[model samples]
Target: MKKKIKLTVWMITISLLIAAVLFVLQQHSFSMTEQKIEIDTPQGQLTGTLVLPESYSGTVGLVVFVHGDGPVNDTYDDGYKPLWEKLASAGYASLSLNKPGIGGSSGNWLEQSMEDRAQETIYAINWAKALPMIDAQAIGLWGASQAGWVIPKIVKKVPDLAFSILVSPAIQWISQGQYNTRQEMILEGFSEKEIKKREDYNAQILLLLKEQASYESYLRIAQSDDLISKEKWGFFSKNYQSDASEDLKNFTTPVHLVLGGQDINVDVEETERIYREKIPKNLLSVFYLPDADHSMLSKKNASSPLRTYLTAVFFPRHIVVEQYLDDLVHFVSQF
Candidate 1:
């Protein structure tokens, strides 16, 4: 009788453990399918991935994802992969491509202009439209960081884009440069006077960028010994503009703007001002998450040990990833 009781207890424990494991697996389980294809761009053949949701019905909406300033990959290290998975789980097909020279794609990304990049995006859209299971009419562009600048240019060219979603986009690279300069000074314990001088220089740089000044002009103004590197300035000037306000005003597609209030890279307040004042209210969706730093992670109290540690590691205090996705899901669903 004693032996039988012990055996029964062992069986029950094993069964409970198995049940718990299964439950955990179920929570994390999501169906996803991926394929690689070569897309024809004006520059050359671009390699990219087409990810489809599990149990997808025929002709679902497609999301063409454009990465920030990084080499695109088949997986999430590109930063947009997690969101792509979320979109897939929500029953949307997603496509992410390698920028011109990276991955399996061909051509040089460094030499491409904004117009060149926008044309590449249109090529991807055309590819998505050719997929039998994709709803070409419902296709949309989801751009983050630098890709924000790319989206408007693409939409203006394509004119048939269903909607666009921008995350932490640099609408005014000049303002963003100044904001970043100030943040760096504050972090380094610079005096107010020194910081103000830096601010003044940044403002000048911003003006030059806004006017679409030649890269040589930007380089000359940014030549001070105390200023940021010429390479950084050249890259920014080449990739972004200081006066995108006019271009934004011409946009007619539905736009969703998600910004972290505590973001140090961009002037969130100035950005908000432009959106609210310049942009038509009917076409915009804006969400400002407070106490959230650039990456959108929530910050603890200023005095907290965790806050200090995170600050040391330069982690953003904003709840960017999750909050942005939630807002994105809500906004896209409306379409």
Candidate 2:
């Protein structure tokens, strides 16, 4: 009788432990129906991930997430996992594609220009619209960093996109680079004169790029002793730039602009200037969060290197994830 009682107690304890583990796993794993689709673009065949909410019944609006310049990894499992999960919970199906040459996708990412990337997005948009579960008329674009450039290009091509959300978008690549260099100097405790010298050098480099100077010539100039700043300026000159604000003139889609006040990569002031002077008043929604750096995290101070480093590590700060998603839900609900 004693042996039987001990055995029963052990069995019950094991079952309880197993049940607890299963419950935790279930909570972590949100039910998201997924599909793998291939989008053929002018450049190459692009692979994309389409995630539908578990409780989704009828057709629902889809949100296509476009990654920045960096290689697109498993956003579903990594960086934007929370946002994707949040959107799924909110009844919005979200799709994110591995940029060409990244993840399981094909093609050479380096060889592709901005236009090529934009074409890829357009192809993905078409593919998403074809999904029976997706409401074709209620599609939206969410772009961050380099995708900012790509988003406007696609919108221009499609013209009738529902809306777009640009997070820390680079308005002008050249200006953004210049601003970043200056911000770095300020953080490093450079004097006013030193900062001015760096700005002048950056401006000259931009002028050279505008003139279609040879890559080698640009390199030589950038490395010249006259360029007082020690900062390297290679890729900045190579990147494509457009009059984003001017291109936005043709955009009828509503735009939600979220900027980190302490963002050092892109000039907050310049973004404000463009928003005020260029973007049409009726279509723009602006939100500037104080103490928030490029990643939207609350920092000890704007100039703290540690904060900057952390922001770089986690782009699109996680602290404001809830608010961002809430705003998005509200925005889409309004339309």
Candidate 3:
């Protein structure tokens, strides 16, 4: 009877611990107090916010958030607030910028190359390093998606970079777009034959870029009824030849790469394969969450493209799962 009672007590204790963990996860999301900050860059005056955590003391490390595609606002006003808050509550400072031509910042993000973005971000890194409240030695970066290309460029040249947190980043711009096209078609329930037709056309574009072929070559790939508009061709022309494989090889900083196994926008398997092939596993901590989609939310309910495009104007509709949130916190805490 004594042994039976002891087992019951242990089980109760375990249940209580699980409940406490769940409670902390649920309550972790909170609003943060941030300072309006801006910096002058050669391209324009870059504007952003340096969000601070409450009830913290001592010089804290700062996380500079590098946004993915499109014009990202200073706060990532759409979806990133919760992440900033969680990081802040865990004793790290966060900063996010208004991309060029967005908010008070000038210049065009679309017009800038990976090189231009890296230079601008390097400027921000220097600015953060010099700040008195920031732990200059612990300045790091957090980026995702298109930033997969941009962050590698930054790390390749800047050896002093402290660390990095990457989520659902792409490997090659060209292949990534192909993956998006194919997977989007699959999600829309297209036939395997239709998928191959699209993928084959994209492959031709890769060959054209490699052969330094003319505009006519790419034009041939654009079908008359295709959803891709002619106006967007400029984007393909500028970035189709770019890849981050070399940049990944040069990365010396400790990196934590997170992926959504169910991500429809990117080829997660290829991404993991390349990272392991290019960098030593010792410098990396990789996570593949099967149930999470590209947004690190549920695959069953991913955010709409329209909603993502309007992030500068409103709040994010989706919240990252507790599992992802926990993994991020644990990774950042290591540094």
lDDT of 3 by residue, 1-335 (tens): 99999999999999999987676555544566788888987777988888888866779888999988876897665477778877887788988888988888888777777778888888888888888889987878999888888898888777777898889999988778888998899889999999998788777766876776666666776666664434345555677767878789877889889999889888999888898888888888898898888878765445565544443233332356668877887888887
- Candidate 2 lDDT tens digits, 1-335: 99999999999999999987786555445457776767776666777778888787889888888777666654634556556667777778888888767776887566566777778778888888888888888899988777767788888899888998888888887667777888888988999999998788777777876786666666676755645222233334345465476665656878888887778888877776786676688889887776667755565634466664554344433434346656667776755
Instruction: Give the number of the best model, judged by lDDT.
Output: 3
Poorest lDDT segment (10 consecutive residues) of candidate 3? 309-318
Model 3: colliding residue pairs: 78-316
**Residue 6 lDDT in model 1?**
100
Off by over 4 Å in 1: 1-30, 70-78, 193-237, 240-242, 300-321
Tens-place lDDT digits, model 1, residues 1-335 = 99999999999999999987786455434457778888876568988888888777677888888766655564434345456667876778888888877787887666566667778888889878988999878888887766766787787777777888777777665557667888877977999999998677767877787687776787677645756445555556676553556667656778888888667777777777776676688888888777666555555533255764544333221213457667777777776
Residue 218 alpha-carbon offset, candidate 1, angstroms: 9.8
Cα-based lDDT at residue 82, candidate 3: 75
Better of 2 and 3 by TM-score: 3
TM-score of the candidate numbered 2? Answer: 0.77
Query: Model 1 clash pairs?
Result: 292-318, 293-317, 293-318, 296-318, 296-319, 296-320, 297-317, 297-318, 297-319
Minimum summed lDDT over a 10-residue window in model 1 is located at 312-321
